[model samples]
Target: MKSYLGLIPISAKVHRRQNRMTILCIVFAVFLVTAVFSMAELGVRIEADRLLEKHGSQELENLAGSTMAQTLYPIAAVLTLLILIAGVLMISGSINSTVAQRTKFFGMMRCIGMSRQQIIRFVRLEALNWCKTAVPAGVALGIMAAWLLCAVLRFLVGGQFSEIPVFGISITGIVIGSVTGIAAVLLAARAPAKRAARVSPVEAVSGNEKGTGALRHGAKLCLFRVETALGIHHAVSAKKNLILMTGSFALSIMMFLSFSVLVDFVGYLMPQYSDASDIDISGSGGADTVDSGLLDTLSGMEGVKRVYGRRTSFQVPVEISGAAEGFGAAESSGAADLISYDDFGLDCLKKDDMLKKGSDISKVYGDSGYVLATSDADSLLRIGDKVKIGAEELEIAGLLKYDPFSSDGLTHGEVTLIMSGETFIRLTGITGYSLISVQTTGNVTEEDVEAIRAAAGEDCVFSDRRDQNTSGTYRAFAACVYGFLFVITLVTVLNIVNGISMSVSARTKQYGTMRAVGMDGRQITKMIAAEAFTYALSGCAAGCAAGLFISKWLFDVLIAAHFAYAVWELPVNSLLVILLAVILAAVLAVWAPAGRIRKLSVTETIGEL
Candidate 1:
């Protein structure tokens, strides 16, 4: 051979089976990063098309300047960073395990006049060789995944996304994937390469290398049988290995929990309120001129699922009977918007969780004197407080969590008083509605929308929004989020399984010796399981603790800061699901390694290098 580097390919060829897991890790990491960026770019394109088609160039320019558009690329960048961190942890653990197994090989190189730097260079280059095949494969898979998602959005979800180009390829995705794959492998190889170079020739040649070293302490027998205790001992004895394994598992959990916040933010950004209508009929200049009888007429029409009407009186003078602490000092007179709701509208509020704590809907359901006020009406108005509008006194029976009419969850300097239609007519002596809304069934056709529009006549302003109900944006966003989450989950499972298998292989001789001394397959299986559980338990604890903080921070930034109505709470459901997943992963990780251990011949295992 011209140089020691010549052995790199030969060694990889000989150990290809052992290196396959490492290669898979690199491929998956590249795939995730590429697919995320690709999908994000496609989402932007699709949204732009929808805007240009529906609202023209001026509206599209306005959207481009909007906060949502400005934040889109930054969000994608953060997601890419998360994917990179996870990939590094998983790939580093795999490389470290491989180095530990090959201590003798590295030591032999050291003994043959190879310098420490040469050994390091050899290990790094060997890792890079795997990327030649892995990177291309990963990029291909990522492109195909992006195309598949585009096809789903374009053909399967055909409302706003019908014009999305399924065959469009993202050059940015390709370049990023190729670069990230190579960079990740190089970064992951650094520590492992350094450790490999540090192996002493004497210990390695004498077959007393670190991987086969005797335990510093005997397995404790207090908690379980000898086999299980030994397994646990194996996990904790190697501090570096334990840390790497635990970190790998922890990163997956953290990513899952952190990304879940994005789902909530998306909901806030594109809120589909419970009372949103497929068709709306409003009087000229928002006057209360639409007859209340129109509600029943629309409700009786074919394909109409439900109909509700609202009566609004803007900037009505109000008098507070109590301390009036809820009103600002400047607005002591309490200028408010008086609105009325029917039974269906009241029910919709309850269904949407719009009522604040301690709200009582029964008090305001009919002609009862109690009324509901928006939470922003006054900071100090509690249920049971009294307010006077005109000559009548009304009790505040409940408060809404937000102003459902306002998109930003703010009331914009006006208190909103909502009561039953009977109460509103009694107080204002007006039976007409300011606006009427209709919700149609899933099979609603254009003819149904036309008939409703024609019945409303030319006096009222009509709007048909059935196309908006198709939920194109919501589905596309959900598919992307869940798809990325699924990729993280798959990578995590593979990492756990690969790490355990490498650990088992490294201790083959030790396991064989135990089997020779009457340790059965079931005992071996228990021992392996105990070790896997140790990693899982530690990882879950650390991950959940860190994840909770990140989740809350993201919630504060993305949801709470923008929406006055959002509140943070414990993510109990996410915790339980992740815990269950970790436990199941631990169980599955032990299956193949234990089977391989059981099938090993004692003599061959003890005799083989």
Candidate 2:
């Protein structure tokens, strides 16, 4: 009679508490998955256009005629394949955790003479019941969510909706949601099912089942059990179980963080670079023209940072320091990328105040008693040394270089010469100067520089270095890296949500016990939320540290090996966003599971326990 009484609660409890949470989780998962796929498709279309431009191909014109599906299908196919793999693992972990948490209940049913198969059958039926109820409701809600969100949230770039590759409820959506729901349940059941078959009836009746199989060992991972009574008990008793959940949550956090960094890279340039070399001047439409004079007028403009200038027109014949000719090709570039002449800006040396000898050092002093030698140049020639450039010989007083490659991993560059405009003219005998670099005080407006340039005449062009670094290459690369990362995070979060949902399912009896002990349903819910919140924040903390370290190392390596860049500075706001995203995703993942605790029943839970 008691056993029959227990059945009534089990049947009613799931619909009341568990069903709502499952529906919420599944619906959110579908929405994210769809978004990832659609966004990827949009990027592919953009990439296709870029490739056409790069290869000088007419494919874009032809591509324009193709329907949106042509572009979307490739992206969807690839993303769906990748997301499914991760989704499967996450669902499995979640389902397994649920099964593990509920092992004692199964064992007690067996103590009543139920066969292993009967236990499995009951559990499977229970999972099916949860699914049958949740999947339909989730799909319905997901359709509504997509409808509402799409209506309000515009795409990054505007496009025709019916024309754009967007997803709505369809046969495919139903299939995906159904499959995903079932898979999570099936995967979650494995461990619990295994335990039910092998665990002894006496152990099952006890409900602890310690020192059996996987659960018997490996419990030390939980730190400071004293902080939370429940956590301490769980650490000691369910070490293996906690490990699984920890791994799942940690992975989710990492993906969330790394992808966050990638998005920032695309949205903004590094500040020092953005702030310094604030404007590039294309010259010769008129000589110094109004453009050159326009620069002086820029200081008063709003958003004007300090502005500086660059001119690379003076070329002096330079002899190699080591060998007779010294000037030769670098092996990496087939020696093709070498610059034969340079016209450095006077302000370049002045801005840094790097001059060690002669004249306000605003400009290079050629053949002076003291020569400013670059580290690379110094290595080639020593102090009091002379490097023959053309017919003039310059004395090496000190070593100086604007080492952009210091952090880029590349060592100092080979070419070495610092000269004042007067000295350069004396040596090169070239009366003309070209190119202007406007280094602003970080807040200078580009428009202000252009206005200043009008005075310098048509000969000068004012722009940002980023604009000159060539357009769209950085954009594409960033998109690809971050797009892949977004997909990974989406999978990670899904797994987390699934795992948390299973956790709630596994602890239904425990929740009921809390209610039995006079704990409010809301209080029990809060505790579960606390646990989920703890797991997420911990993972985010760790992931953020790891991500920052990794990206910084990568930044250093790229500058040294490739770009010859000088310093690497972190984008603080960007990193903050990344960490914030990790926490946000964690909170979101916990919501579905937390809600389930509010439906606990004292009588039903005590029976299960």
Query: Best-fitting candidate, measured by lDDT?
Result: 1
Candidate 1 — worst ten consecutive residues by lDDT sum?
323-332
For model 2, what is the alpha-carbon lDDT of residue 265? 44
Q: How far is candidate 1 from the true structure (C-alpha RMSD, Å)?
A: 4.3
Residue 571 local lDDT, model 1: 83
Q: What is the lDDT of candidate 1?
A: 0.82
| Model 1: per-residue Cα lDDT at residue 105 | 81
Scored against the true structure, residue 573 in model 2 reaches a CA lDDT of: 60
Best by TM-score: 1
Question: Candidate 2 on 117-148: residue-level lDDT in tens?
Answer: 76666655665566666566656654554444
List, residue by residue over 106-183, the lDDT tens digit for candidate 1.
Answer: 788778788899888988999899999999999999999998888887787787677778889988888888888888
Q: Give each model a TM-score.
A: 0.83, 0.51
Looking at candidate 2, the ten consecutive residues that score lowest on lDDT are 332-341
Angstrom error of the Cα, residue 284, model 1: value is 3.7
